[model samples]
Target: MSEYHIPVLLQPSVEALVTDPNGTYADFTFGGGGHSRAIIEKLDKGRLFAFDQDQDAAEQAAKINFEGFTFIKSNFRFAKRYLKVYGVTALDGILADLGVSSHQFDEAERGFSIRFDAPLDMRMDREQPVSAADIIANYDATALHKMLGRYGEVTNAKTLAEGIVSARARKPIQTIADLLAVLEKFAPRFREYKYYAQVFQALRIEVNDEMGALRDMLHQAAELLKPGGRLVVLSYHSLEDRLVKNFINKGKFEGEVEKDIYGNDIKPFKALNRQVIEPSEEEIKMNNRARSAKMRVAVKI
Candidate 1:
């Protein structure tokens, strides 16, 4: 399990959510099944359901033969409907480790790491039609600027977007190296790696529609959870953390919490922690990816 991908905040996340050994649970992102395995161990007569859209993750899921374990090969955006088909109308706890798995970033052909010069294919699910390369090649300057500015939060995003548009006109931006070649000049001299990561993150997010799927999953998770059920999410970036925080506190990604006619809040979930949780220095030292993770938990009201 450790060789596949280290689960961030494994103990804290699992312990925080799995309050009942005999209670039903769902792991919305199975990844390498580290958290799923931990969840299943704590369950006695409880049933566990997991979702993973990536084929590699599906293959990993097949290897887990734990009792009361079921794997769903679909995006968690469809979690509610899919679990309903399996007669799981309500769940006692739901967990989502939203970080890209080590396997995905480590695989050179996936184009997730800045160190790798592979095809610009950053789709979490290979079946997805739009790859990062497609976004780079097809997005107009305005669309590209929006993606980089909003999703990546890159400095000088507008300039980079215009540069990409000009560069792609001479030749198609089809690979990681090709895109980098055009944007390298715009990168901050001392922070080139960070700039590349931001660009890649934006492209990956757009290619997979990560934010859209996350919003859908959160809505479904709220509906799927029983009253007082736990909802745990570990997000790697601020964009995702913001959404999770908003949804947990306000019941929607944006705007203020709605009020009922009786003058009480109508939010579906209440946040468990006043502030986000971070991994310990020891944990982050061991798994560098854990450094950026922010975990938030909520209880359904």
Candidate 2:
């Protein structure tokens, strides 16, 4: 597990999640089974359901030998459907660590890291038909601009989009090196790495439909959790954190929360932490990836 992906906010997240040791729980992002292992250890007779779309993660899940653990090889968005198959309608708690795993980034062939010069394939599930390369090759300038600006928040999204269109017309951008050749011209001085990361992240999110999946999963989590059941999410980017925050506080993704006839906010979950929780300086020093993590805990109301 340690070699695969280090679990961020491990102790705090698990402690908050396992309020009832004998209750059913789910780990939506079973990257390396780190969180699932911890949750299983804390359980007495509790059943744990872990989900991950990645084949590599499925392989890791197979290594765990716990009677109470069930590994579901599917996207977390279909969590409710899969859990229902196991007769798990109501959950005690659900923990989702939302982001790409360390193993994915470290593996050069996965095309998740900026350091690698591999094929532009950043699908979480390699079985998926659309990839970063496909998006770059086919998307129009307007579509590309929206993706880069909205998902990546790239400053010069318009210019970059037009540039990509022009560059690809001459030759296709099929690999990491191919994209970088065009991207280098647009990147700011001494900030090439950051620019590359932003572009790659946008492509990854689109390829996986991450935001859409997250919205679906959150809605399912709200319906699946029992009263007072916990929903603990650790989001790495501002876009993910914002969505999690809105859903927990407002029930809906956009606009103000709706009120009932008696004027009570009709939200599903009550946030346990008023402010988003950040990793301690000590933890950040040990794991640099923890620096961007923002943990939010909520309880079904």
Candidate 3:
């Protein structure tokens, strides 16, 4: 499990999540099953439903021999519909660790890591038709600029986008090396790697439609969770953390909370903590990936 992906904030997340040992639960990002295994240990008569779009994760799920576990090989955006198929309308808790798994980043052929000069394919579900290369090749400069700036938070995104358009016209940007050739010219000196990371992040998010999927899952999770049920999320970046924070605090992704006739704020969930939780210093020392993790816990209202 450690080789596949070290589960960040494992103990803290599970502790906050499993309020009832005999209640139903869901692990929306069952990357390496580390969290799922811990969750299973906390269960007595309870059942756990795990979801992952990655085939490798599904393979890992197959190794779990627990009778109480069910692995759903689908994007968690469809959690509501899929859970209904198993006759589960309400949940005691839902745990989502939104970081890309270490396994995915380590796999050179997966095209997630900038260290590799592999094909530009960043699909979390390999079955997905569109790849990062396609986006670079097909998207206009405006579309590219929007994706890089909004998703990656890349500075000088417009310049980079225009550069990519000009470069791809001579030859297709089909691999990491090809993209880097164009990106290098726009990247700031001494910060080339950071620039590459930002561009790759943009491509991966677009390829996966991660933000859209997260929004769908969060809305469904609110509906699926019973009153007082927990919604625990570990987000790796600001884009995800902001959405999670807004949904829990304001009941919507953007704008102020809604009000009823009496002017009381109407929201689906209430935050459990005044501030986001971070992994222990020891955890970050052992796994650098834990450094960026921001965890938030909320209860259905």
Question: What TM-score goes with each of the models?
Answer: 0.98, 0.99, 0.99
**Residue 90 displacement (Å), model 3:** 0.1
lDDT of 3 by residue, 248-288 (tens): 99999999999999999999999998999999999999999
Ranking the candidates on lDDT from highest down gives 3, 2, 1
- Displacement of the residue 183 alpha carbon in candidate 1, Å: 1.6
In candidate 2, what are the lDDT values of residues 1-301, reduced to their tens digit?
7889999999999999999989999999999888899999899999999999999999999999988899999999999899989999999999999968999999999998879899999999999899899999999999999999999999999999999999999999998999999999999999999999899989999999999999999999999999999999999999999999999999999999999999999999999998899999999999899999999999999
Clashing residue pairs in candidate 2 are none
Candidate 1 lDDT, 64-112, residue by residue in tens: 9978999999999999999989998999999999999999999999989
Q: Which stretches of candidate 3 lie over 4 Å from their true place?
A: none
> Candidate 2: where are CA atoms >4 Å away?
none
Write down the TM-score for model 1. Answer: 0.98
Error of 3 at 220 (Å): 0.4
Error of 2 at 263 (Å): 0.5
Q: How much is 46 displaced in model 2, in angstroms?
A: 0.1
**Candidate 2 global lDDT:** 0.95
- The candidate with the higher lDDT, 2 or 3, is 3
